[model samples]
Target: MGDEQIDAAALQSWLRAFARSVAEHKATLTALDAEIGDADHGANMDRGMTAVVAELDATEPGTTPAALLKKAGMTLVRTVGGASGPLYGTLFLRMAPAAGTADSVDAGTFAKALGAGVEGVVARGKAELEDKTMIDALTPAVEALEAGLAAGDSLQEALRAASAAADAGRDATIPLVARKGRASYLGERSIGHQDPGATSAALLVAAAASTLGVVVGG
Candidate 1:
């Protein structure tokens, strides 16, 4: 936000903000997972993001956004527990290349990069809409972001729409039977409970909206 650039520092802030959100919601996330998973999503996410922040702080400020994002991905893969580590890591790793080599990127570029990341999650997790996974949140948010931009909305407006879509997606998962992850083992039993992964993914979008808003001139 200081310089209105979606550069390395901005990306670093995004990760840090996400980590803080994870910490704040850790208990709720864990509770949700306890109903259908190993009850570790919150802890794993918090640990991974903590590591990501540490690594980012140790790196130089002049680093490009792509490098910063990729480093965050690797940190998550190394520090996070469970399948979520790889899946979330893939999201950032895929985004790195899509973000290109620029020191900063425009809102449209960020949208494309974010979409690429979501696709990575989809491919790595092999999950689709209504699968009751993080895909439930990420897919709709990305689609909404793109749609907002296509409609010529400001970046902040697009982000708002994305966040809303993510929240709705998270809530919608409450009625779905999980088709992936440990929750899938529960079959129909997985229904009627909000997906932990989807919930956390919604936080991710919300964090982005909060952290990127000022930078994009919201």
Candidate 2:
């Protein structure tokens, strides 16, 4: 497969879509959190993405993927407080190196870049899948991306599969006991609650699908 073409306008549109989705689902996310967290995951992400969208609009970084991601990472780091800020910031920061020069990336390149981002998150948070953290969602999403690429899928197909995998991973978190982060403090009490990080990670993958014009399926 060849490198998928994405332009500055597409990237900008994706960011805007992300911000809108987070805002629209704010209550749902916070409600999921009220069961296990501080009930601020949605609010925090909404605020952070709002800032990111503003920066994207004001700066108009064009098709420089690296610069755009870097700016987004910095914005998240500065605006989003908590473990999420650092973790997500690191994910984008790590991805910048791979996405830096190209206006578009092929499925294989995107998969590799996303894998790097997931590794950064793992290293920063010291968390793993089934630990009731974002790793649950992100790991499976990246894996699915790899699988899709290996199968010679188009970038859109890969993104759609990745998004579906992420959603499933997010749902799976509900049955696992927390072993990291604030939720871990609850021990077995965390078993029935959804992981806020996983929820947000799923949102990220979903945003990717929407931006890339992938028709996601259940």
Candidate 3:
């Protein structure tokens, strides 16, 4: 059988759903940022995702998943503010090549793309686990997703596991002293504050579970 070209629509839906999730949690993200970092995580991500959706809507559809993700990455880098724009932008940009030339991406391919994207964030931000950054959420989610898939879990189940891991990673950020970004400036004061980047990253994973999980059905 051939690749399911319809998966392109599912990927598109995933991006749009992520935008909506960002909007829904904007206030919460802003509050988290206000606690330790620049108070613009929510606003910046919201703007970035809005631009992503608009760009996708306006531009002709891409021939492959890689092209779509690349376009989205460019929009984010061009539109968003703060350190998040570049970090998040690099994430998608890196994922583009990893997403491959297939018109439709399968569950394994999706996971691989996410892994590549997270690696980009880690490299760009120079962050690791417990750094109180998005990597905190992203790393665990990818690990959990890959683990779940390897264990023979369906895509929906794997995504659910990934979402749970991301949420836990986000929560774990609290009580840790910041080791990166503006939050590090606070030193000991950064302790006890939830990381805004991790919070939004959790949302990103959850959005994938709800959107892509439904469309692909593993």
Candidate 4:
């Protein structure tokens, strides 16, 4: 676990941790995508994150989380292949502006920035509820984070809520026929398998929870 502050160091660590998680689950992600997609989600993401980590290692991104995240987004855009590169790159890019110039952000600000990130993904992907996309997991998690923040929960508690919501949303995608992406080409055939994007998105949110010391489902 790391410090609770949403600072540059913490954000960098978050990206690194996420990269590791994606690598660890690469096979599962590709397997899920193989059921209805190009089956390259895992390889593409792994390669991109590897580049991100390398860039992070090579640069001294100062102390601003915004700058760090922006650079990370660009790295993904340049290195990652497939539609995932643009979608994920846009996510971090939007978050970068929301993060502002602050070295650290409070829970409220962090939630707002995260919400902005998800909105970017939605805009870029044009996905909606029950679409069987990453939006399914991301939207619910952002909503839950906001709800928890509104209810005055601690950052950890709010993250836990977000993570749990993301997990539920991921599970919900299991029975849905994808209405977007390559999976949509499968039509009715997509219903039985879980969405690769949604599953990976869940892992991302869970990584945040764990990195920030939130006890997911606790």
Query: Which candidate leads the pack in lDDT?
Result: 1
**Stretch of 10 with least lDDT, candidate 2:** 1-10
Name the top TM-score candidate. 1
Better of 1 and 3 by lDDT: 1
lDDT of 3 at 190: 97
The true-versus-predicted C-alpha distance at residue 128 of model 1, in Å, is 0.7
Candidate 3 runs further than 4 Å off: 1-6, 215-218
**Total clashing pairs for each candidate:** 0, 0, 0, 0
| 155-176: candidate 2 lDDT, tens digit per residue | 7788889999999999999999
Q: Tell me each candidate's TM-score.
A: 0.95, 0.93, 0.94, 0.94
Per residue, candidate 1 scores C-alpha lDDT tens digits across 1-218 of 12234767777778888999999999999999999999999999999998998898799868999999899899899999589999999999999999999999878889999999999998898998999999999999999988988888877778889999999999999989989989999999998999999999999999888877464334
What residue runs in model 4 are displaced by over 4 Å at the alpha carbon? 1-4, 213-218
RMSD, each candidate, Å? 2.3, 3.0, 2.4, 3.3
